[model samples]
Target: MTRPDVTLENYDDVYRFYLDHQQNRLLARAAYAALSARFRPRVRYADGARDRLRELLSSDTRLIVVANHLSDRDQYTLAATAWRTPLRRAVGRTRVLAKDELFVDPGLRRKIDMMGSIPVFRSKNHGLRAVADAGRRMMDVSAQRLHRGDVLAIFPEGTCNEGDPTRVQRINTGVGHIAVKARKLGTAPALLAIGISYGPDRSADVHVAAPVLELPGTPMDVTRLVTAELQGAVDHAVAAR
Candidate 1:
């Protein structure tokens, strides 16, 4: 059944699930298992990505994993890919940043929360105080999570490109802001870019580019660096198509 009152205005149990940090590891494993069993995506890494991924996984620094969004099933495929790749060990601790609207779907919401997704409320809807404040709170907590060593996997483009799935859209500045804030507070994490290309045969191609380690200058500078790298990744991933 669909949940109608799951909005931030009436946050109830649905929205609460999004705010909760205690993720069920068993459920997460189960979700990944089910995803793999059902839809087997052929995940492939780019040159030197395998070795780099292993090194990144072994490190204690948090990872800000950014990827291109294509469909609703992107998250599932991401989790499954991580489980099969060198990131398998770190999947359980990663928090997937998802839109708050996804929580409105009772069925999907449960699976999203179980798989360790963090709800994000965008403030572009209306400029109301509450909405703006929620956005600020999201950024603050997200920064804190990174400082605490929790990996965040977010879609910088914000939404899926329905008009042209092959191309990556413009990135929002939120990700860069979070990274800069984290750097200022001391603990600096790696900005890793991931690209996904889905085939007609239900198989998916996954590529992980090298990580961005240097965080210099202002937030805009860091944001542009990450944005350009991610765009390059998306273009490279879909170049064959």
Candidate 2:
């Protein structure tokens, strides 16, 4: 299937295309296998972090995993690190919320699509007024995916933290909105915040927190909860590094 153009005009179709698409499991595993040998060795987790994540994955509870973005390579690092832990269980089923521009390159887009990435139209790129409706559609599809039992991985910071990698940037309310929408659709999703930090040896330190099951009343309130959890996760990752 030809991918729809990642433009405002094709936004709806682009998202819908991925929503119904089933990834080739064999291909997904192959890709992970190739990267794991390199990344698995370089990535370390906080003590008990792996066990915490493993327990969550063992349950029927749906997860919304949010992480702080430190670099463009964060996704790759996360992917590789996950392959060594329980996170690899959600490999083919996870829908990653990625920025719109990542889909522009045809070559990379195929891999992105196969990895179950959903394009996110950001207001910074298209202007607030322009991406308003399209953003809603993105969130709706995300919520629907969650309701369908797919794990969602998002960099709630939205962009890499170029200034202070130690601190988690302000998280957007989009995450909260998606979780709220999923809840409305009868899916009680749990939040899992992961923190990533690079060490002097270039190894990655990843800290995964136990899932936060209780959410606050409004979207903003949920966002605040996520903010606090993510910051604590980041601090753990840094200290571990």
Candidate 3:
């Protein structure tokens, strides 16, 4: 049943209430599992990558998974892969920073909202104010969730690069800001660099590198390290393609 105040204007507040009320992390896990099962895309991983991610989760680490965005399906593919891990199950909720357009359509919007995505506004007219407002909101929500020990996933590239099939472009600085803010609040989680690859058939393959760099440091340093690691991972993935 939908809540009384569950309108688009109050979407975030209502959604947060639902997530807190349900308190059922398994619902998210099950949803992702179903998505994966139906898709049934073959998954390949670097040796011990899953294990290493699980280990990181075992620690009090709040992760900001930086991946090179390729397609709309990329997010779901990553969610499916993460769901396969007991680590994600243990971590509770995995929140994704998604574009505001995803919420334009009622059905897709509902699904994204249920999946714990924070809608961000990106303007083509170079509206800096809208972008900044969205960024601030995203950071605030991410910081709050990180405080609760939830893993936050973001595509630092800002948008999917369909033109560049070879490598990831330079990353946006928003990711670094979120990391630094989380640290200033007290518990600064490790920033994890996640590289996602898609085969020609659209099957998903993932490689998670070590924390490219630690947080509670300067935002520029974190952004630089994340960009380098993500670029390298995308290069590797493209080579395999």
Candidate 4:
């Protein structure tokens, strides 16, 4: 089925498009294959991480995957690692929250669509007041997706941490908001933090932390927890690299 053509001008239209979006298995498989071939990353899940994730994938518990921002290539490496690990189970079932600008180009949009990306109108790109309503809509769509059994992935840092690759930058509360919304929608999402580091050997090292089942209620509290977990995961990835 051909995906709907969404200009992303109307927030409601964009929300509807995602709510009704169909997963194209062939395209998703091809993209994952290409990512695996392009960047063959070595993945190392923290002790019991794989088992914990397996349980989550097998259960009805939805996961709000949060990761640190390292480089633009982080997404590619992360995808490649997932393809090589148990995360491949969620290959076609995950919805990634991506910046809206990435959907502007037709060619890139097609690839991103195949990857199940949900366009996010970030306040950094648009003024806080301008994107406020749209941001809420996007978060609602995201929560609905989770409630409907789609795994949600987000980069809490919002942008690449160019200052220090080893240290995780301050996380934006957007991820917290998404989690809180998901909880309100009765999803009660679990947190899964993945850390990525490129080693001196030019090999990508990924550290998947154990899932956090207990989540705080407020957005600020959730953001603080995510920041701490992500930083720990990143520290492990850097040390193991």
Query: For each candidate, C-alpha RMSD in Å?
Result: 3.6, 1.8, 3.4, 1.9
- Sorted by lDDT (best first), the order is 4, 2, 1, 3
The digit string of per-residue lDDT tens for model 4 on 1-241 reads: 3444544457777878887585696778778878999898767788898998898888868999888877778778877867887777888888988888888889999888889999887777777898888888888888889989888889889888889899988888888888899888878899999988886666787889999999999999999999999999898889886
Q: Each model's TM-score, in the order given?
A: 0.86, 0.93, 0.83, 0.93
User: Candidate 1 residues 1-241, lDDT tens each?
Assistant: 2333546665344344434465677777777877877766666556787787788778876788898888887887788777777767775677888888877777877777677777776655444565665565666677777787778888888877787766778788888888877777787888888887887875677767877777655767777877777777766767644
Off by over 4 Å in 1: 1-6, 10-20, 123-130
Model 1, residue pairs in steric clash: none
Q: Model 2 RMSD to the real structure?
A: 1.8
Stretches of candidate 4 off by over 4 Å are: 1-9, 200-202
Candidate scoring better on TM-score of 1 and 3 = 1
* Steric collisions counted per model: 0, 0, 0, 0
Pairwise lDDT winner, candidates 1 and 3: 1
Which candidate do you rate higher for TM-score, 3 or 4? 4
Which ten residues in a row are the worst by lDDT in model 2?
Answer: 40-49
Among all windows of 10 consecutive residues in model 1, the one with the lowest summed lDDT is 11-20
What's the C-alpha lDDT at position 153 in model 1?
A: 87
